[model samples]
Target: MNTSELDLRELLSFKPRGGAISFLGQRMYLTDLFSHGLQQMELCRTLGPEITQSIIVRAGFSKGWLVAERIKRQMPDAWAEARKGKLGPLLCSMYGFGEVLSSQRRDGIQATPLVETYFISLYEAEQHLRMHGLSNVPVCWEQIGFASGYVSNLEGRTVYFIEDECQAKGDSYCHLRGNYLEKWGAEITPYLPVYSGICNETVAAQLADVLRSDEALPRNMQDKINLSLKLTSIEDGYPVSNSYAMRSLLEMAINVAKVPTSVLITGESGVGKEKLVQYIHKNSPRSDKPLVAINCGALNETLLENELFGHVRGAFTGADCSKSGLIEAADGGTLFLDEVAELSPATQVKLLRVLQEKEVRRLGDTETNHVDVRIISATNKSLEAAVEAGEFRQDLYYRLKVIELNIPPLRERTEDILPLSRYFLMKFNQELGKNHTGFHYKTADLLLSHNWPGNVRELVNAIERAVVLSAGPQIMPEDLPHEIRDTLCLPSVAGDIRALHEVEKDYILAVLEKLDNNKTQAAEKLGMSLATLYRKLKEYGALQIAICSWLYSIAAILPGV
Candidate 1:
């Protein structure tokens, strides 16, 4: 069988190499999209990951038309359907068509109403639109961004009037609120009294001028209120998380500020468990003291003890000179013991003695040294289980775990995933001198869908690799390592089996498109509450094009079916 040609035998037994070779099966442009967002495809131009980068470059080097043609052959239904719209949702929806353990409430096995159309993906809708063969970028594209301004009372109600003017043409709409309001009609009359009240052309013009006042609104907002928005200013910033878990962790750290109690941080490695420990120390009385970290797993009993406590002159063969230990080094600060579960029984005793006696003894020194050090130990495993199995000392466990700060794993705390991914992305982007702005929605969804077993550490490595291989302004899916492709994509692999909302909001929006933005109508049709529909749409991230897609989908499908 020729390597390029498909052969049954090779496809059957092929065990893709875990590093970058597993991506041998992925489509080229989709892969590059990942690489672009990841910044790895760009890195490949300088220092490439040949196995993965080569496939993406070789595949995407051609224009998209050819790629679309090939996609057409392999996935004809996708092509035929996309021909009716665009292939984007067909592709982009796959990013979230996986097993993601989100905080979204799942209502099991609801029957779909044959009378209603659901939100399909924008990419999918685009594919169906593209099937029409108008593939060139439109002469002009417009975006109507909908964002809520800071809480402000409008008219009589303390209501937030949704800003749906074009981000690029905000200024154009500065003179046209009446026109926009009239376009929406009586439905919005209660929200904006100006729209409900009768006004002449002159009066309407004055209102537009007032709303678009140069002295009042920012220059950027005034300039593009009418034109659809450009890509979000999400323009390549570090992602930061502000969720309850992080808040709880910060609160816990603050609560332990006055005491010198030992803090044992338990969580999967690379989940910022160490950082959480640092936060605790900084908030503690020992904020000014140095934080000395020792990885117990990397050292044995003797070395671990020596590292933890100082040694006297000639205590061990390598002890040529007397020196202060980590505990002494962190005299006024905190001592962070990483991988505490890996400590030996003998080391545990020494550590326990430090806690109980408030002093540590050097290996060879006859005198015991008293030091003021806050002990903060972290482990990737459960200390309780370790103590029960006699792998760890129970007394030591109890001492170190006085304040157990359990850092929730990345999977458990889903909210932090994107921000953390962007944090690593931005860091790698700058350090590597690449201009990768951000991950596309599809790739972002992929990142969110992944069950990060390796936690933040694995995400960091993936971003670093993407930065190393990135080609342009964004990181795309293909730039990810084979481990991500093979392991993390486990959720997407069971695509059709995923719940309605779990498939990401992109697809949900596409389904909503079948309904034309009517929440009440769509809800009545979907057999869910209007509130539930709105909440789910936002939660699934389907709100962006959900209403429009629903309109377009209904126009297309309702006519046909």
Candidate 2:
């Protein structure tokens, strides 16, 4: 099985005698496999590379498991002999990967394969030649995974490969080194994503690794940790959050769901207020009934009134027939009135009556319809200001604000930027079918520095655009939108009036953001030791409240700061 002694004819002897080319009891046409591989490439391009890589590695692991079982049953002694630096290259070659030019066995526990003429490399090279810019990260994921799976199962341990040199990345050949899970701890943590699909470790462990490596120190690190716990504890379909501010709000929302009190959600547009509404309704006692939602701001006063309180025949100019309104439809459930601040003063009087009487009077109807419904309203504007300005009804506002939840904007919760970025990336990976692993260091820098005026919705759009336009693998700074990059790269001349300490703070934060908030990485990047970075972060109160609060305070006072 060793590359030096690999016998092609003998390896071919394992091929079954059948109509279609069969290898080790499995039959398939070369074209079929090749066609499937091509289809996977297309899916990767569409879905984002992260998902595609995960699927490929998982498929390779399953194949390796089957091969091990078959070989163990047919030739138990052969399995043991193959362990002496034989199985990896033999299986790799038989599966049409390439010739393993050489392999180094270490302590009979791990294997390193140096492959030439590899199929993955050849395919990538040809694709890049055709497209002129298709190449990015290593393209030989399945091959590397197959070797790791074969060895891991044979040795009864967790083993995986990291492709250090790849032809796709412009290397001449592919080089993969395998090791046990703990063997490369911390050193190969970034590459550990390759094992995510097959590793036996629980999700908590994986998440812990993310938080440890990419530290997002919030107002309190423990509070951030508590937020992570809340994130995992919530029911499905909730917008994933890592910021203490958001998570604390979610915790309150869940508690409020236990009561029948009216709730008003306030936040910036695109902050997922409707999602919060849905979460509250789904967790409430009325979850069995429909949860209706409407945007009051999108309708004229007449249309809004008709929509909320229903209309009988001939009630309005366009009324063709009688219809029940959103409130009646949500009789036993919850009605979410989004942008409730936009309700006209006249409409507000009607809403107040409905909230007070628990009955809705349909326009042109003689009798009011009694209903049991919990009201949940939301707005992106300040209802308080609206009340003071005499635009919103103070009585209705009080009725709606029985339990208020304010969702923090994205920029304020800077700790959430990376987590939300990954969440959206994964979402696009599944929805679009592109195989994107993650952002490049510089790209992360740009993401953190950009002042996101559009909040979470804007972040989602940016990630989607980047994923679609990015060539492959990691997203580089150039892959990002010009606005994001331009905003972050503002020129600073030597004559700039900023103080040295202020300049140092900005640079330190920039480095930390680029490094995904890892203090260690930030320290090294800034040519300072870990202690010094911690001391500086403590002094500036950046580490105390994460980064935004401190930075925003300075920016506000500095008049373009």
Candidate 3:
């Protein structure tokens, strides 16, 4: 696998049979080109560019480490001495990061390669063209982090790569600078925010100092609720879910957990569908056994088949050793397939067989093995819609949906938002050693009012960011992420230019009518007391009927009218 022996064709080639591309023992799946860009755009708009960049950089850094490890194992001698300079071009080719026109060692440090076709640069350039200057920085944090991570492991030192210029920032060509961190000292401090999970020690210390000046207050009601819910949340590894809808869902999950039926958990991404699956797994009879989870969407069909069902040593190219699949690992437990809707039709047919027979046949294996395992699959997409479109198998959909649980989105469960926020705030405060008590009133109002498109995941990220940035005891609106803070705190019906009293009357009447004039049910839905509902109804001249109905119920119960 050394540079001289590396076959470029073997490194990256499309498989005619599977329509999948192989890269470094991994499968490359394809999607709409603009889909990823659009997602990044939305993340930046919601979490702000800096936070999103940090997230992307962290992801790239992890990926780079994995690739570095793979290359080292495959080419031990080539990795031992860094002279080959072939790994960069190989990675660039595989990842569409551009060609390394030239790379050299300089003063015992590796020089940043002159990339001729930087993928991220072109992506950002097109994004800016479409958005007309939506980005302000290099917009290449992931690429920079990837280069730094790969080189740092290869060189056996802490290396850093900085995007010195980017086409997104109006530069003609995206250029980068690289060196060991010790060689650059504070020179690279400006780029720290783009890197994820690296807190500046000085800033954290300053925050700790400020916290010491604040009073150690007793736990209030909200604090108590947060503390209790946070403890349970941590215990179960679930997010804070205190709303009626979530509670009912949990109750149903608990009841269904007693059975060995296949379960399908559906929700938008980041609503913690996996967490609910875990909750069910823990409460089930198979709690003591392994709970294996695989993301069907992350792997292409070839790799996915090899992973889920495993293979013999001669299964395919690079299958040097016999491997057991996740199904075997979860023989007596549960297997959760995240993004199960993304399973290729071929894989779906094979999975359907497993569900029907409770047995798995490994690739290139002559025999099938019986396994006792529960299947709990989750997906963000509508599996029914996919099935209707013939993208997903109808039988598999019905098999997985024997017991379905649709977790409500965060907007519908607004009561949980504040508790969840405070829980995350407290959780991060402990992690960061901050004494932040709670959100400011305005900040709380903003959180309550804004629609969290990303749901609990987004809220958690916002709290973590606020925790990291807050310099005071309270998290102010300024400390929140821009999307939340920038929201206009107008009335709910901002477009309806009606008087406040009239609006209230209309809303109350609508609720009562929706409930068939059942004042108790209307009061419960409105989050008000029966007396309050009666008073509002009386003021609106709609109480007499409700009063007569109540009297009629009492008279009937007493056998007198």
Query: lDDT of each model, Cα atoms only?
Result: 0.51, 0.68, 0.70
lDDT of 1 by residue, 289-326 (tens): 79888888898777778877878899979788998889
In order of listing, the candidates' clash counts read 79, 14, 0
Whole-model lDDT for model 1 versus the true structure? 0.51
Residue-wise lDDT of candidate 2 within 1-561, one digit each (tens)? 112222222222111222333344333355444555577769778987788877777667656655665554333334546656666666776676665666766663343332222333334344443454546676666776677667766766766777777766777677777777666656568666756747523322433433332333221101000011112323455866766798888889889998889999999988889988988888888899999999999999988988899999998688889999998999989998988998998999989988999999999888899988899999989999999998888899999999899988887876677667766776786689766655643465467667888988889899999889876555667677777876543213222254667657766875665555778777877889999999998986557545544455456679655
Using TM-score as the yardstick, the better of models 2 and 3 is 2
Q: Which regions in candidate 2 have their CA more than 4 angstroms from the true location? A: 1-235, 489-561
- List the lowest-lDDT window of 10 residues for candidate 3: 218-227
lDDT for model 2 comes to: 0.68
Worst 10 residues of 1 by lDDT: 142-151
Which of the predicted structures, 1 or 3, would earn the higher lDDT when compared with the native?
A: 3
lDDT of 3 at 410: 93
- Per-residue error for 235 in candidate 1, Å, reads 21
Judging by lDDT against the true structure, name the best candidate. 3
Between candidates 2 and 3, name the one with more favorable lDDT. 3
